[model samples]
Target: MELILKTPIGLEKIAADRLIEMDREISLSVKPHGLEGLIVVERCSDKQALVNYILKNVPEVESLVNVEVETEANLKSIVDAARKVSRGKISEKESFAVRTVRRGRHDFKSIDVNVAAGAAVQEETGAYVNLDHPDKIVQIEIIHDRAGISVTNGFRWKKMSPDKKPALNFFNKISIVQMPYLGSLEGAKEVGARIGRAVQAYEVRELVIAPNKPVDAYELNKFIDGVIEGIESRFRIQCKSYDRKVEKVRVSVQDLYQLVRDRSGEPMIVFEPEGIQLIEAATKLRKIFEEADRVNYLFGSREGIPKGVYRVASMVIDLAPGITLPTELAAPTALASTYTVISMIEQNIEDN
Candidate 1:
């Protein structure tokens, strides 16, 4: 039976092994419970076969923990499904909450009246607009003459720790540059130089600056100059404005196949394509986040991911030149290998 075990970062290998062994083990002495089951993940292939094997051999095994066992390749769909099941909104404060409403459907005309009444009764301005911690997200499902009104907070809330957090500020920079609302070119340059120095201190290969809004072309140029002057050899800085427009990213599965097939080439193109793909996927994922409720299955077209399976398949493909992969896709690849199970998982998540 094959199982793709999912774990948080910084998990120990020994614990992972124990979890894997719980499915099946050759030696009963290893377990205090004297339980034994044997399953070899020879390759990261065939999810159904693995599921059937586990269910047939272990009748008590209703579901596997940590591992996402699905028949389809589209993980984005899975996320969307789960999200629908756990519908809620994320606040600017980085918190998730659920809403419920008693009414079936609300009319804007009536809603305005209610808002005005609420403001008048509450003796507060903008009380209607300030729908913080809304009592409910009113949902109305009308069927014939009968209607179903649901006030739902589907998913439970848990505080995500800061350590497990992904980078929030998408603008990848060594440091932040602060200037007055209308600062001078020198100020921009100084900010860029500080960022460059910070990037050098951190030993990063590249530093990027993303202005919140478009800047004067000359001022932007001066900022780049300061960034270039501050960094040492092998470090460079780039400045660009944040793109508000949504963009579509394309990747040839064949091109990725060939690149992973050849990892030792000069100017190692491994990082570039993967980074671009990830960025594009991230952007798309962000869009889906807006319509998270109605999103049924987030499958990419042929130009992108066909299903969750495509990204998973990419994970199995040889990432390093002339290298072998482990039975457990979660296992680490060769030290020299640029590909990793975690990397593939993250790619799938971002693509989703």
Candidate 2:
């Protein structure tokens, strides 16, 4: 008949008062015996109604937990209580974990309780332990003299952890080879600026302006100026936003054909209509990205990349089968596609 609620340190009295006024059947104490930020309901008529009211109306409280079974604060007692609560609720086919949060000082650490209880639950239920992505979680909330044990479903939304391979780690190895978008000087500058921002958002290693053929000299100069401007503006924001050191993307210029011949050792990927479907090349692309130290992504301006260059390239990817993306959309899409398939590949590798 006890429910524990958590609030800001000084607001525990206010939260307890509100709860007391709702139902006279409950007797409660705010910050029981000088512990801060806790409201302990010694007796209550309805636990479900109180939980619903707090969630709908109470803004002062930060967290709330319903105590299923109250046992003496000791390792053996805690393990037996958890086993009783976890009976037919969890199956052996599902993965599970034990999470302990201890509030008061004791002879044993929180990890000790977790290990003892976890082993008991595993033996009783015959379920496997998956700490990172568990299907169910046995919650242990331990106070100074008493412990609360409950079994809840595990949260499965967290995509990145120390054990999981992050897709962002692979972005720094790519060099974007973009052709000069020539025509009007003003239009070229605008296109170049957008592409610059898109590529630098991921903090890619390099952005190479590669003109496969002769283009307007004035238009090229304006485009180059805009690229530099866009990079600095975005880099400044990144430096302020991120806690770690931020690196500006390197800008370089090399003719598309010569650059391919020079960096023949690296993997070169071209985005064009004549190439194979993305579904078909995804596995091969994942292998190339995993093994190579550097990857080159070639994108066209107004005209597509020359057909001759496709032969020497490692893979030609038609990202969208029937549709051609705009110049600005193309760079970001290429990066997104690369990250999506590679993440799936790494997850599969770990799973198998």
lDDT of 2 by residue, 51-143 (tens): 888888888888676778889888889989988887786799998999898888778889998898888888889999999788899888887
Q: Once superposed on the true structure, which residue ranges of model 2 sit more than 4 Å away at CA?
A: 1-164
Model 2 C-alpha lDDT versus the unseen true structure:
0.85
For candidate 2, list the clashing residue pairs, or say none: none
Model 1 earns a TM-score of: 0.19
Best by lDDT: 2
lDDT for 6 (candidate 1): 24
Q: How far is candidate 1 from the true structure (C-alpha RMSD, Å)?
A: 24.8
Cα deviation at 257, candidate 1, in Å, is 20
In angstroms, how far off is 70's CA in candidate 1?
Answer: 36
How do the predictions measure up, each by TM-score? 0.19, 0.58
175-255 per-residue lDDT for model 1 (tens digits):
121221124888766655554454443333233333334456777677666656655422332222222321111111122
